[model samples]
Structure formats: C-alpha cells, structure tokens
Target: MAITEIPKGFKTLLPDEANKREKILTSMERVIKLWGYNPLFPPTVEFLSTFKAVDEKFEEIAFKVVDRETGKLMAVRPDFTPQVARIVASSFKDEAPPFRFYYKGKVFRDVEGERETYQIGFELIGVNEPEADAEIVSVVVNILENLGLKSFQIDIGNSEFIDGVIEELQIPSPTTFIKLLSSKDISGIELFMEEHHISGERREKILTLLDLYGREETLDKAAQIFQNEQSLSAVKRLKEILEILKSYGFESKVIFDLSERKGMKYHTGITYEVFHPLLGCSLASGGRYDQLLKKFGRDLPATGIAVNVDSLQLLLERKGIFKEEKKDFYIIDLKKERKLAYEIAKALREKGFSVARDIIKRSIEESVKTAFGKGYRYVIVLNRELKTPHHIYLSSEKHFPLDDKNLIESILTAVKEEK
Candidate 1:
C-alpha cells in the first residue's frame, strides 16, 4: 500500500501555476533589491525555540520534530522573520547600525489546516526612526506600482492607537472586546458597549464618526475620540508617515484603519495590510517589530513587509497578467543524430532561445504534433547533415535553413518578424 494523498490545505503547483508564482516573486525581489536590500536564505528548519522566542503563538501551528542527534526539539520554519532576527543577533551582532535584507521562501502554519505558502519579504534591522518604517511602506507601494497594480490601498494603523482605544473604552474584558471588534460584529459591539455601560457620547462617536477612517478628515475625526498620549502619539506618527508618503506622491494609495491591531505578536508599533477591491484578503502585510530582536539578545529596532506570493500569483493569473512561458525551439531528431541534436539545442539556448530536445522515440509527425501542442513556435528536425537541419515553423508550412553559420540570426529574424 502507498500513501496517495497529501495533507489537507496542501497543494502541488504544476508548471503553469509555478511559472506564474516565480515571475511574481522575481518582480518583487527585483524591487526589494533595488532598495539596498541583500538577499538572505534562511534554512527550512530550525530549533522550535527560535520561532517561539518571537511569539509563543507560533508553538501551536509550528510543525515540531525531534532531533535524534541532540535529542532536542526542532521544527520546520513556520516564518522567516524570526529566523532573520536569530541571524542578526547571532551572526551580525558586531556589524553595524542599519542592516537591510530581503528573502523569498515558504512558511508553514496550521491556521487554515496546515498549509504552506510562499513569502517574499524584506527585513530592515537596526533602524528605529519612523523613516525606517516609512521606507518599508514606500518600498511596498513602489512594488505595487512596479507590478502594474492600478487599484490597491495600504491600510495603516498603530498598536498604540488600538491599545489606547481599549483603555479609553474601559471595558471589562479587553480581549473579548478586541475579538468582537476585529470580526466587525456591529450588533455584538453595540451590545458589549451597552453591557459595559459605554453609551452616550463615546458610543455615538465610535458608531457614527469612526465607520471607516480612510481620508485625512476621517483621521482627524478618529483622533478626537482617543485622548491617551500613546493613542494621540500614534495618530501624530501616522500623520508624519502620511507626509512622507505625500513626498513620494503615494499618499493616494494609503488609508488609515485605527481598528487594525491584529497581526504577528512581534509587531509592536505601526502595522499595515495591503488590500484590493477584488481580493477578499490582504495581499501583503508588515509592521515595525522594534522588540523582536531583543529575544535574540540584540535590542535592535526593525521593520519589514511580507508579500503573499501565492495570493499575488492568484490575483495576477485572474487578471491574465502572467502566462506559461512557451518554448522557442523544439528539436526533433529524425536520423538519430544524438550528438548533433544536443549541439543544436545548446546552440539555440546560447542564442537566448528556450529549446527542448525530443527525448521520446517517436515519428517526426508525432514529434512535430507534440511540439505544436506544447506551444512551440519553431521546430527543427535534425537529420544526417551536420550543417543543416530542417527548421519548420510550428504554426505553418514555412521552413528556414538551420545552418550552423546563421542559427542564431535565423531564429532572431524569425521571432522578430513574428512579432
């Protein structure tokens, strides 16, 4: 007997889908690198405590395994940022003030039944000022525009603002109130407020004034409700970040959501989530984790953004922005000139063409049919002649001389003319 099923929430990516994902990751990585971020590849597994150091919440969903060598506990990487923190403390401890790194990898979690998803993210360590946070936010906004995203918004908020709101409300169970507010239970929130004797002006302000704080005026309206220094400071910082975004001409792509306090436990300051009208969930999210590095023995300030490649790929595919790459030339060997076939394939590839040689022992007609079916635009049938193979266009009966002297030029001309 054999196991025929993968676990629930896990899925394999075939060629087409995988190609889309890779393209999305590539575009994101390019932008991240341009912003002075070097690439870092964290291992797929680490000690369970590495992740738990950031947040014990990871212990629940993290896939744990026992190490036989040391008999200590280890686990598959549930997230990359924690591993980055570990590296910063253990490896780059004596380095410098500001360290910038970007990464692309998969993270495992049991939130939706033990699924693994790809993440392409940037981590800027050793910077505490709001400029660091602003840079991260602007980089993401730049990425969205670079990827041709026309309609999207980043919902920004601060944990201090949220905590102040809870304080101002003076509710019995802040935890329960937060849960209800997070789920947007209008009736439930009202009932809870009534239960806590939170009526009159406070209730009216929350109900009518803070429906959706997207515009600048709404930010002011929301600011009027919170009186605590932390919340007011959160509001002031948000306005400063907005001014910075305005300098980048990206203020239009931003909105404020004071109710957004739910994120990774490590996010201690301003947090944000990316949204589009078409997707039901956030496409990317990040925040300032000023205290995460302290767990690793380095009290460094950090901020970063993590893009959900799986979700981004889904959105791109739905928009038909990315498609499966097609082969440029398919080599079908008719005379069994194996050496010539290999040489021709290599030559085509060297000339910037994607070529695939016929591996299956099949007839020329069958091979040609397969090439056409697989979306190849050019097909070459190799025979006894070393100097020339019949280069046939898969779309029509047109043929070109596949001479060694002009192999690249001929293909380039053909592709240019086709375009």
Candidate 2:
C-alpha cells in the first residue's frame, strides 16, 4: 500500500493555532457587533456569472468546477463582498437603505499557493456619505486594536482620483498603466512615457503621483498637481473622511496615499489598505465600492473591509497575545463515591472553572502524582468515607481536608485562597 499525503496550498490547524484563530475571530465578531453591524453569511459557491462582471480580474484565481446538475460553471467564493452584493441586490432589493452586515468565513482561491484563506469582514450598504466611510474605517481600527495589534496604520486612497486622471488624460491601455504604477515600475513608466512622447510637466505630474503618500499634506500635494475636477473631488472626499476619522480619535493610525491603484477596479470612491511591521503584505484591505451593486441590479453605495484572519493569527502567535487557560483541578474519586465527584466537577465547571476527572480508579498517592505531573494546580481525592476529601495543592504540596457537605464551596474557596 502507498502512503497518503496532504495536498499543497492547504493546511489543517492543530489545537494551538486553531485556538488562537478562534479567539481572534471571537474578539473581532464582538467588536463588529458592538458597532451595530449584523452578521451575514454568503454561500460558499455561486454561479460563475454572479462574479463575472465585477471580479473579472479574479477569474484566473477562482476555483471553477462544472455543476453536473445545471451544467453551468460554478466557483468557490474568491471574495465575500461580491457575494454579499449579489444577495443584497437580489434577495433584499427593496428592503430599504443602509444595511450593516458583518461576515466571517473561509474563501478559496485556486492559485499555485495557499488555496484556502480566512477573512473577517463587514459592509455598509446604501450609504454614500463620508460618515459611512469613516464608520467602516473605524470598525477596522477597533477590530485590529481589539485583537491586540499595538502598532498599525491604514493608508487611504480614492479610486475616483486615478480613474478621473485616466479619463481626463485619455491614457491608452489604462489597466496596464495602473498595474505598472501599483508595482512602482518607475523605469517602465518612464520608458512608456518617453516612447509616447509624454514629456515635461505632464509626465512629471503622473510620475509625482507615485510619491504622494504621507500625512495630510499629501492630499494638498495631490490637489496641487491634479487640477482636474475629478481628481480634486477625490482629494476633497479624502479630506472629509479624514476629518471624520480625526473626530473619532483615529488620526494617528491614518496615512494618505494617492498611488494605491490596485485591487480597486470595482471601487468607485474611497479605498484603503492596512499594514503592520510584522507582515510584509497587507494585514487588511478594503474600500468604498459604490458601483459594485449596480451590476447586481441595485445601485446602493457600499464600503467594507476584510481582515486577513490567518495573517493576524500568525502575528498574534508570534507575539504571544493569547494563552490557553490553565487547567485548574483534577478529580480522583473512589469507585463507590464516583457520582459525588462528578457532581462536584460539574458544579465547578458551571461556575466557570476548568475541571478534569479521572476515568479510571487509582490509589490516592498515584492519582496525586499523576495530576501533578500533568500540571494540574490542585487534586481532590474522594474515597468511600464520603466525609471529607483531601485537597492537595500541587505546587506547595500542602494538604487540606475538605468537608463533603460543602465540597464544592470548600474547593472553590481553597482554590481562591491559593491564588
């Protein structure tokens, strides 16, 4: 027989990693709920046409399969926002304005590496005001902080500015130009500009946009260089959103950049990405996609962010942000008094304690030694006498006889006293 092996770009998280991931997700879900966002779950698979319009760029990355029943191309979810849009537009088309939803799930991308990924995200639909944008950004800040990320920054950009620039400039092959700018391929852009006879201030303005990233002053610089209405409007929206975020006391985590033009084809207005020193890539990214729902038959404005849960978990594990609760008590009871020991263990657990009971009977000495070896803080011995069980504090090796009538209370009190 041959050996069985796991496939590449997939991983099974063992206890330690899984535990941390759960804690991070719990904290994020709580923070998201606190901000009045309701939970949402889009299907894991949808027809290929559902994402074909807005997510053409992701077609190569999406894992596609043929549905034998329908004979249509179906794909595992590559992103949640588009699926969310489809549901909101068709399922809740006439529901009303301003729906707030949060989601946590795994998304699959069929690239050569890391086919499966996890994301925690939220969306604010049918709202176009700057406040909606700020709220989404605030939620991201709150979630990262709640997850114990001490140092991180969000770089904000406006898709409108670049789109307006391309339209106003009538640039040929705009997508390729944007890709080159995203990669910061200066030589390629310079050569392209020269080959196209684009020289002097026109070329300078386009090239200078690459360096427009920093504090509030960056917006001023962008406004100065791109005097067109659309570019200036983008700058104006960015400034307004910044002011709103400043009022929320998140100014220190804000950075303005106008050169971020990737992963924003569907984003109509505000776009942002979050970074941390611990990771080479972005820890989270999101933005306003006002035009996304239009493809689904609704014209609701929307903005949201998706945190790379896997990346955040790695950072937290590296920094030791979460620790497993220590096992507190181990119960060893005589055969005849096993029921009483179980009752006591149940009571302790109901009161929010981690209690473990031995499945097999052993001598008091053997049980105590085993509990200590397994790092249990205390051991309780219940014999047939059922009068008082000896409580042994493993670290101090001190013994106390606990009254049976008040066993639960006495054990709890003893543990507290030890602390």
Candidate 3:
C-alpha cells in the first residue's frame, strides 16, 4: 500500500466535495434550528465505559484507542445518538424536560464496507407522547423536503410490538427471529417457528408481518392480526403518528413496516429507516430510544433521526441538485498596492462575499484567466496610482472607476444586488 494511503472505509473529502457537504449541512442545520433545536457538540472521544450500556454491536465496530495519561481505553465515537443521550443524562441531569438538540459532525467506525461518515441529526428529549415521535418524523420529512428529496420512503415500525410478540410467545434468541423478519424469509421464518414450537393462529399473524408493508391500509391489516395488547398498542401508536404526519402532508411518503428490527438495543419505541429506490442501502435511520438516557443517569424519553449525509450527497450529485459556488470575488493586484487590495478584500468579506487575492507575480491576463477558470464570478484589477477607471470589473468586461470616496459602497453595488 502507498505510505500515505488512508485505511479502508476512511475518506478524505476534497474542496469541492467538502463545500458541497458544508452546503448540505447548512441546509439541514437551518431547518433543524427553525424547529427550535439548539446545536449540541458531543466529544469525539469518550472512555469505553461510556458505551457500556449501549448496544453490544457498537463495541465490536468501535475505533478503540489508549489514553496515554490514564492508561485506559477510549473509543472514537461510532454514533452520535448515544453521546446525545450521555449528555442528557449527566451534563443536563438537572435540566427540565423537552430538550431539543441538533448535531452535525463526523463519526468513525470500524465497520467493513462502510465509510466513516458525517451525520446530521436531532434529538427530542423528555417527551413520551406519540406527538413527540410524530414531531421528529415531521422534522426529518421537512428536512428531506427542503433538500428536494421526493423519491424516498420512510419505513416506520415499533420494535416494542415485535418484542412483545416474542415475549408473549417465548421465542428463543429473538435476534435470529428478528433477522428472519427483516429479510422477509417466509420459509426460514416457518422453519424457525416450527423448530421453536411456535404454531397457532399467532403463527399465521407472525407470517403476516412479512407482507404488512405498504400504504396506510397496511396498518389496518396489522391491527386486525395483533390481538395482544402490546401489539395492539403499537398499531394504535402508529395510527396516531400517521395521522399527525397526514396533518403535516407527509403521510404519502410513509410506508408502514411491521418487521423492521430496531437498529439498536436502546431503541424502545417507534423506529424508522429512510430508503431511496436508487440506493441499495438506507439513506437515513433513527427512532425512539427512551431507555438509552437512563443508562447515562437521566431517565428521559427521547426520539431522533440521523440522515446519512454521505449517501444523500452522492444521490444529490447523481440528481444534479447542486450548483457551483460562483459568486466569490477575485481581486488581482498587478500593481503592488498590497494594502489597498487587502482593504478592498476585507470590505468585500465584511459584506458577506468570499474574496481571493491574486498574490502570484503574473501578468493581468494570466491572473484573470486563473480567476475565471476557478469559477470566480467577479474579478477586479488594482492600479498602482488610484484614478478614475484604474480598476476593471472583468465579469462583464466593464471598467469601473476606483475613486477613494464611496469606493467600497460603489464596488459592492457594482458586483451584484442579489446575494
């Protein structure tokens, strides 16, 4: 392998990709903030003990490191939701209910065939009502809508329903059975059910879960088969969430999935996974984890969603949804008016323009060529002795005077009125 080659599943985002990612993050952050969620930054590294209560699967894929000072093992964060729960449990133990927080950052994991990725997510804490779950669903739906994602489906399910069935039937090693449900293995499920002596009208209902996925009527089918209170309650909760989503006009995008196993042990309530028809993997996934915070110290009911931005970025690129950032300013100072150029650049920056100064000892033609090649929309040439028409705006090939009086204001207006 090359000496500088990064490890498998690690990525190095170049400028254009990073810029696009920043734009995507900004778009998501704006919507999250508008929904009354404040930003919360979790630590990149935590003592391994912090994850003791989380799903055992996280430990297997965690990037572990040794702490030099303490001689203890620490792990780079493999997920953000657990850290959010940790913070709510310990950091804000005394705080009141309904903590709304959003975060966007990198998470490193050792999972094979999966890239270390950037995640944008939000957590709503201290609410156990179905409205809270519905609210988070609406929030993510709004986020995807803002990003112009129309060809996607949010598969919503409640793990409690499935777990309750297992508990009621005394199913052994529930994970194995859950896997069968996830894959819709009708024969495998039948064989497992037979081996476990699980045969009855309920067996038929268990098989029914494999096909209980579709429009709103899918929930009605589930309700008819679920006789147990826990399963019945799940159907009711789903109905409530669906009704709330209907009120938000996002119900059309939801598909009721009764067989989706919860992503983690912490997820105790409604769970959802977002999928795109064009992508083989999930584009986003999250759910309610009411018991996770209790492990950290606080007992709070919370729900959240994490959008797989890397996957979404790729999908957006394929869809050609992003445009080049071409409004940046390029100032070419052929005459050594370094200080004046700096002042102009600063002024443009203060007015919310990204300015780049040409510092190479090149001719005016070459510098302007470089600026245009780099997709800079506005270019200005500086003069040694300031005079009327000494500078030029190359975007329109029109020369504008560089008078000292009202220079910044005139230049700002000369660029463009549109931001």
lDDT of each: 0.81, 0.84, 0.83
List CA RMSD, all candidates.
Answer: 2.5, 2.5, 2.9
- Candidate 2, 302-336: lDDT as tens digits: 99989888888888877777765457888877666
Which residue runs does candidate 2 get wrong by more than 4 Å? 1-4, 168-170, 360-376, 384-389, 396-399
Q: Ranking by lDDT, best first?
A: 2, 3, 1
* Winner by lDDT between candidate 2 and candidate 1: 2
| RMSD value for candidate 3 | 2.9
The TM-score of predicted model 3 comes to: 0.90
Looking at model 3, residue 160 earns an lDDT score of 77
Global lDDT of model 3: 0.83
Which portions of model 3 show Cα errors greater than 4 Å?
167-173, 190-203, 384-419
Show model 1 residue runs off by greater than 4 Å: 208-212, 384-389, 400-412
Question: How close is every model to the real structure, measured as TM-score?
Answer: 0.93, 0.92, 0.90
